[model samples]
Target: MHDHEEHDEQDSGGGAAAPARAKLFLEGRYRKLCRDLPQTVFYCPECKGHPRRRRGCARCEGFGKLTRDSVQELVGWVAGKAFGTRKHKFHGAGREDVDVRMLGEGRPFVLELLGPRTFQVDLAALEAEINRRNEGRLEVRGLHWTERQRVVVLKETPHAKEYEARVAVELAPGDPRAAQALAAARALVGTRHTIIQHTPERVAHRRADKDRERWIEFLSVELEPEVEPEVAPAPALDAAPELDAAPALDAAPALDPAAATAAANGADAAPARTYWRVRLRTQHGTYVKEVLSGDSGKTRPCLAEWIGAPCRCVELDVTAILDEHGGAEEVVEPAPADDAPFGTGI
Candidate 1:
């Protein structure tokens, strides 16, 4: 993604001489894309995803792979075509499960164009094209040129991320226990909690089996209804509360967290299913899913433990990478590495 050595001195644009190396930067805005796609090319383990396998692989219907879609392939294709080369590397700050959606400003990445023959193109136009082709799927933002050194820095620099998670909950409607969960979640907002995580069960087969410490910096918590409530009709002008209303009722009803959400959304009844929208800030490489499940007790002080009930994150969206100026980590000096485009894909 970024080479340590400065390549900017060379002509990366109009100069006649071929540029030593050129890289493109893009922040991928994934709204709904990648839900069913992998971050990189997924080769079938059984047949190596080789299309020409002597015995047609029934698993992949002889196509040799499970899915043809991936964030890397989609973004890489446009850049490769524009740059006139297919050789590149994907360098991401971190990765998310394919089931997760990337949102907000999108994830930053560098695509290293290896041995580019066409040194330069209109970046703005290229960005527009990428978005147009991937409409409703993914969008590229902050597209520009950068040094290869950034790739290594991006790799080494720890990324703190924010996510919006929809979790399935088991608490009964109007359960007094909800307050305990609410209080526990709120207590984490402005503090830090160190957690010990074993290699998550899902990735244990490929990742090293070991214990790792990660931190959870809580951001926010909210109760979400399964179905969004309709906005109530505007109140009659005369029915509006007086500017100076009486404060006479001493036995006012206790606050119902769901009531607040319901009043705002116009619903008078609870949904059939209960869900909570919890926003979390976590260190790079932390197992976010495990933070909720405790991975069968491997992760301590997990969300499950905090709320004293079983919960699972059913939907997730990345809202931010809080490592740059906007977040906790200081800006890292771009370090060097290969010349291929760094695609910081999950």
Candidate 2:
């Protein structure tokens, strides 16, 4: 009986030892598999020499150094894993000429960083990193955590813009016609069908070689003294009793159409001559440069064609952008009813 009990105990001990040895072997095999796996096989910058199941590898900090799509994927993963949400969008203010540098305040813009892992980010440090990486080429400011709706609003809103450009012109000297031409340009209003051809010189690579119709409304123009100025009586004199009081001489009758047409035809006989400083307000995506240049005769009734001279926008500036579909009309105040008593209902 004693021998049998001793045998049974030995059998139990052996059974326990077998499992211990197997566990050790399994752990060793797992560690070897992790170590021997090549980092390139994973193609993850952060996962080199790390277990596949690890939360994140210290080497790349979970960011794979690859295409922008990779960055976006990693951002999505981080947001989902850390914050349990997903929201983000990119917004750029007034795009550059692709080659042109946007100087001064770098254009006012707002980026809505939404549903981030942590809205409370070290924005100053992030800005520093971006600036450092870009070498001052691109900069960002007012980097605050915001909502997704704000991003939509930013994209939709028509932000006012300002631009400065130098233009070349073919102009004559010592002619009064230029002043009239500039006046006509400034007087134009509303939408005008101006067709523009996409040329290989400027925008062929990115844009399709097609024609686009755009609207341009000239806000104002300033012309050089190519002609002498004509002086008229001051407004105060016109208002004085000497000439004004004569029963206000009913407003002059409208001119006959025949006479008007004759005057217009005569006005076009002279050649235009002057450099102009033109200011305009227009909708987004209207190619101001092409409008000014006539785009090799693509623009109809253009500044060049209108004046019958090779004309260019000597200087151009975008003063404002009018929102076409802004909102409901403003509520106007109702005029008080005549003969209504004070504090009485109408």
Candidate 3:
């Protein structure tokens, strides 16, 4: 009986020593091709992601997500199918807004696969499938093996991002005032400036309400007339083969056809809509949208303040992400012409 008791104790100890679960880390870079998609799938805000009853939830319109789909879901689904695991986590270097598309080589990310039944995977094939499955919405490149610690480095590293925003000035479209403002904005380019920015109102709820100072290393603004409905848009502005020595204006950038149509006619019939294609480089975590609108005076030295007009960021795109050593994980391909597609511009 004594020996049997000792054996039972040993069995209990071994059971307790068993591992909880297994996890696999796969790292790569991905481009978020649409402005309307989120980086992760979220539960219904009203339901707190948990449903009281089966079948459907009240919030999220029973879709179980605030949006239709996210980069996380898109990639995870395909990866899960390949790896034979239903549970996974997406870790991104940094996330862009739902309304902002990520271009360039794409943002660095790691996908953690839990309880993957299979370890063997062709990363190149997986990357191709991810891109092919999502098509124009998302693409993953430079897929490689990585460890869990990589997620930490990705999150903690301070990165710089280059961005493009299409801003609409309040001035009448044909007004010469547009030219003066454009020049003023252009002259400020290549001149480094610092500004104090409070957490923007849109994100204040989730972010700490505080002031942060950031530097704008380079900036350029160019004006373009809104293409009339009956008229076709001009050829897409050719992106420089390389980043320019100085910030150069892009008279043509991507625009939302619906928004452009709405603003096509101004009140005075003086060409209602004129857009400023703004390209800027800034430190990570800068609230770029607030940089243009001043966030109701929370952001100083804003474009709105300088031009003496109200401005808003109607379209935003992340053109590049750079490491501290100026190494880019991927390169940027030239964007297609204006008529290419809704969110194809880089």
Candidate 4:
């Protein structure tokens, strides 16, 4: 019977029929240095990565991608070389938009090497080699052997994230109403808010048209006047000759109810060319941009509503990602400098 079992194993290509394929699981963090870099390669929307010609493709213009490289490609290239395999899979805990910067300790990720020639490679050496190759463009750290199940945990786990956004307010400088608006913005701190957000118009093309509720653990805002020439003083209402005829009217026209409500809520007196800084903590998957502009009333109780003025998110950065144990990932650098702000020069 033992001889028969050995023959069966060899005949089935299990033992002597072929070499066993190896699998190596890795756990680590990836930091994206460039703002334009994405977490993964994006193929041409038209060809989906199969370019018909070498000279050029109409959709991708022969470049093959909207972007040249990504965190996934960088890490995969190094891992595949180390394992002597060209096929591998990259799994990240979460991803940031291409325009947004990923700072702090970096995002957790796992790389799965399939059909590797060997599993005897050193993870620490691999980490150093990968970092050395990518340099300032990308960095990987804390690489160690991990189990396949970790990918599921990282993908399904929900954790809060902290973000910093440079916001531009429609309020103007030197206006008395600016102080009131600033005060309202500051009041958002320490308040727990539940918000319902509709898909933002910018991303509605790919995202489902749906409403989702999210929680804001904390919010803080600060405003400063733009550095520009002082505005010319406005002529007094009494000095205007056209106003002299208005006193002759029997009575002033009735105020529109909508306008009256806006005034009462302090939303009518918006300032122009003013900017602010916001630090916010929110549950995973919350649309921070929509939270800023209200997405045309798609996001209820938004910052624009709180400040009683229209606002826009000029730049955004992920400052931290909290782990299940309430520990924060490594924060390599502080939040982006506020002096230049977003929409300003690099």
Candidate 5:
């Protein structure tokens, strides 16, 4: 009985060993295949057709072995090998007009260095290496280890942006009408939706032509003032109490309940001075630019059409963009109770 039990134990041990041997054999085969496969041959531009030499040719300066696509591929390979990672994703804070250059602090960005085995790697050194390798055409900073999930927020956040743009306006010569129109635009109030018909000409290759609605809450314009000639000094101050007590012509009275109610409810009654330096807070996705230009009359009651003068935005900047899913309250006033019918003239 003892001999039979020992033999059973040995058979079970052999069964486990067989699978281990097989796994090792397969791994060895894979490594052998990788080694036996020929190293990819890159043409030497300097040598005119020959393979690259050990020291490399003087003419191409070893660049004969490099191509843009090949360099990218090598970067992926080295990053994977050194970090033992799968892949990486790069996220930009905001997209530039391809034609526009990002000058300051090079717009905030996040890079998802995925599946890294060496999470403890020195990030500053890695960033420096990458910047050196790219020769500063693209730069990276704020490099810190991050998780995959943060990439989602980086992509979705509606970050408020500031833009410095130079706009050109086409108006009829000697048209003071243009300035008046721009002023009227600033004083305009209330939320307005404008539908934009995106043209294929500008974004045809990358995006589909689609109609999108954007809301506008505020619009304003400023023009360089014409310098005035020197004028004589004004008269001396008046000491009369009557003059001091007299309300200043520019001063307006304190809040009138009726006027406040009207303004809150969006009545036709608006403050005087049609021209204003309009500053307003509005909803997200508002096409302030299209609202100013009218986009071929897609935006109705536009500043240009309203003032009977061509209008364009000189500078546009976003002060804030509220969270899309924010919650707001609507006030409900209590209704007055109806009087009961008198039973006997009580």
Candidate 6:
């Protein structure tokens, strides 16, 4: 995961000459095909992308990369071609994992055009071309010109994000434990929590290993309604039920509708597992994936802990990039009190 606001400072296409600059908000999704690509170009680590070494390198097949293209490449190719510039820097408000799709208002980004031959080209046209060239792979909106200062503000300012996660949760149907889990999940909504998070295992190599305080507020959580399956194939919508298919209520009363439906779909009589849709708002720098999974117990009081089940985020989408980085309250774990009896002396 790029952590959203990641960037690198690099030289312009024209070397010492000043580069043309612009700020545009990239509100786009990494569609199915491009999900594996990172937000930036990933050079071959084995060969360092060196031409001579890359030629003999089987890892990247001498192409200098393990894979083809990226979000930065796709946008840069089109914009750089229009500007006659080969180099540019990509700045994003925050970066999502390559597999996660960005939705809703999208993430903010600033493109440093870097020594364009001409600065008078129509931005709307360039935006269209970028979308058209990468139709299924990538898309963007709000292409316009702005100053270099916006880039600084984008990196320096912190912003929270809203995410929608489709999580697969498990619970034994018809067990008392299922009701307990449901109650636990419902109790979590409309509450604010401050938790201690150790660096997640996935990014531990790059991130500092220390306890960090992060906050999240659950806006809403909804469970998909369970459906009772029918023994026979369900009739098409708007079609009348066949009288011969089911016997009269008085004659076949032994099997009630509820019992009949349950018996028909008997896989222990319930679906047992279903998706739970979660909508939450988190502070900047908080890893949403780790928050849901508890990251092998590294994150305390997490969604997994609250639900009392193993939770896996199957689908994730950003709902918004909030402009505000709200004030954070410190996390203080209270010390346990002495267990002396009320009437007894210490």
Model 6 CA deviation exceeding 4 Å by range: 1-34, 56-61, 172-176, 225-272, 326-346
Please state the error at residue 248 of candidate 1 in Å.
66
Model 3 — which ten-residue stretch has the worst lDDT? Answer: 1-10
Model 3 C-alpha lDDT per residue in residues 1-346, reported as the tens digit of each score: 0000122222355464433456777777889888789998866666666655313765676666788888999999998998899998999999999989999878988898887777666666778888988888999886666667778989998888889999988887768887777777888888778999988888876899999998775467877656757877676678536655655578557797776776775433553556889998877788899888898899998988888778888999999998653346443332334234322332
4 or 6, which is superior by lDDT? 4
Q: Give each model a TM-score.
A: 0.71, 0.41, 0.77, 0.73, 0.41, 0.70
Stronger candidate by TM-score (1 vs 3): 3
Q: Residue 29 error for model 2, in Å?
A: 57
In candidate 1, what residue range of length 10 has the lowest lDDT sum? 331-340
* Model 2 TM-score (2 dp): 0.41
Candidate 3: misplaced stretches above 4 Å?
1-20, 53-58, 231-271, 324-346
* CA lDDT of every candidate: 0.71, 0.42, 0.77, 0.76, 0.41, 0.70
Residue by residue across 1-346, what tens digits does model 1's lDDT show? 2332235453556655543554444333333355776766777777877657815777776766677877777778888888788877777767778788888767667676665556546666777888899888777775666666667877787778888888776676577777677777777777778999988878987899999988887778887744666999999999988778667698787889988988989697554345788888887778888898788988987988988888788888888777732385443323132232433221
lDDT of 2 by residue, 1-346 (tens): 0000122223455464222110000000000011111111234444533445234655545544222232223222333333334543334334434223344333333332333333233434444454454343344433333333443544566543333434444655555665566556666633444445454356565576666655555545555544466898578855766655545456768788998997888864655445666655444565667677777876565766665567765444333323443222222121133233322221
TM-score: which candidate is best?
Answer: 3
Highest lDDT against the true fold, candidate: 3
| Order of models, best lDDT first | 3, 4, 1, 6, 2, 5
Query: For residues 1-346, could you state the per-residue lDDT of candidate 5 as single tens digits?
Result: 0000112222455463222110000000000011111112234545743544524677656555433332223334434545556564445433443223333333444443444555334444555565566453444444443333444654666543333333334543346765666555545645443444453244455565666554444433454443467999875577434545767877976899998998888796432122223344433434455555676765654556655655555544333223443223121111122222211111
- What local lDDT does model 5 show for residue 290? 54
Compared with the true structure, what per-residue lDDT tens digits does model 6 show for residues 301-336? Answer: 888898788887887877777755644322212112
Could you tell me how far off, in angstroms, the CA of residue 297 lies in candidate 1 after the best superposition? 0.6
Residue 219 accuracy (lDDT) in model 3: 62
Measured with C-alpha atoms, the lDDT of residue 233 in candidate 2 is 58
Structure candidate 4, residue pairs in collision: 104-331, 104-332, 105-330, 105-331, 170-271, 171-271, 171-272, 172-271, 172-272
Candidate 6 Cα lDDT to native: 0.70
Q: Once model 3 is optimally superposed onto the true structure by TM-score, how far is the C-alpha of residue 213 displaced, in angstroms?
A: 0.7
